[model samples]
Target: MKVAVVKYNAGNIFSVVHALKRMGVEPLLTDSEVELRSADRVIFPGQGEASNAMNYLRERGLDRVIPSLTQPVLGICIGQQLMCRHSEEGDTDCLGIFDAEVKRFQPVKHEDKIPHMGWNSIQNCQIQNSKSSLFKGLDGEFVYFVHSFYVPVCKETAAVTNYIHPFSAAMQKDNFFATQFHPEKSGEVGQQILRNFLEL
Candidate 1:
């Protein structure tokens, strides 16, 4: 299968590349709209300022190409945030694949950290009914996460994780799937998630 990892001016691309290699797959990395759209599967990975990232996507016309992709696409971290309707991080408007908005973490208590980094277990939201392709063979597993903003619990949410309050850790809507956490860096369980995505 031809998997294309949409390369934008973002971080965490190498980690994802390595993860795919471990999964016995080597995905083409490109920002070209034609290349992205032609791939069998697409992985939209991002890590950086939202506005700049969206600007880059727009510059290459991939901002439109991405949303129109027919194959399964996975977004991670800032990639996931961009898939939402809007984000508070840069007061940015994003690709509306998921019908949710990204907001900065509002720590209700003094003990809560702002970024909400590290490992956390996911609470299956069961939005996808059967075990989702992304969560196949994994049940309520802990995965590595590092983010300051989060998508509010919404209709597309397939998995939930508690930070200050329960929020979307993973989401699915047709061919689009996303996770706020970095499954590539989450070790074994993370590998399984990536493998599951490859299978899908």
Candidate 2:
């Protein structure tokens, strides 16, 4: 199976590639439209500012290619944020795969950090009387997260995690699946999630 990891200006692509390698899949890291479109599965993983990433995608014409993909596509961290309709990070418009908005986390208390980093457990939202395939065999599992902006719990939300408040830990809409956390850094559970995505 051909798995393609999208190459963009954002960081953390290498770690995602390493995770897939551990899963026994050598994925292609490419920005080429042909390579991305032909792949069995596409992984759009990134860590960076929203507007900057969007600019890169648009410049490379991936902004147009990504949403049209027929195969299963996974977006991680900032990649997930960019998949939403809009983001407050830079007052940016996004790909709109999931009809949701990304907003900056406002800390109500002193202990509540701006960037909700580190390990947090996600509760599967159980969409349509069943858990999402992304969370298959993994319920109430802790995943590594590092971000300040979050998509609020919405119709597309597949899992929820609370820090300052309840937010989308993971989301799914048709062939598109996304995670606000870093699955590559989430240990065994993360690997399982990647494996599930690959198998799908």
Candidate 3:
């Protein structure tokens, strides 16, 4: 299967590439509308300011092209945030591929930090369809996460994790799948997740 990584001005691109490489899949990294639309599966991965990232996608017309992809699309970290309807980071609007919005974490009483970083375990993993191509053999697994904003627990949530509160660790909607955590950094559990996504 051909995997394509949407390229843009953002961080964490290579990390995703390296992770996929370990699976013996060399993905094409590009911003071209034609290239993206024709790929078997497309993965959008990013880590950076939402506004700038959106701006870059808009400049190349990928902002619209991405949401219309028929093939399964996966978003990681900032990519997941951008796939949502909007983000609080820059008061920015996003692809709206998923029926969700990204919001900043509420301040805590000297306990919770703004950017959540490190390995967190997921509980109450609601993988409604056991046959889901993603999460194939992985269940109740932990993944690495790093973010200041989050998508709340909802119907689309496939997995839930609690750091400050129960939040969406991973979500799936039709042909779109997203993970707030960085599976590439989560070791074995992560590899399983990526492999599952690939099989999708």
TM-score of each: 0.97, 0.98, 0.95
| lDDT per residue (tens digit) for residues 79-195 in model 2 | 899999999999999999999999999989999987999999999655666889988888888999999899999999989999988999999999999999999999999998999
Model 1 residue 23 CA deviation (Å) reads 1.3
Write model 3 residue lDDT over 25-138, tens digit each, in one string.
999999988889889999998789999999999999999999899998999999888998999989999998878889998966688887899888876655574544567766
- Where model 1 places Cα greater than 4 Å from the true spot, the runs are none
Q: Candidate 3 — which residues are off by over 4 angstroms?
A: 127-132
Candidate 1 lDDT over residue span 170-189, tens digit each: 99999999999999999999
Q: State the lDDT at 100 in candidate 3.
A: 86
- Model 3 weakest 10-residue run by lDDT: 124-133
Better of 1 and 3 by lDDT: 1
lDDT of 2 at 197: 91
Best by TM-score: 2
lDDT of each: 0.89, 0.93, 0.87
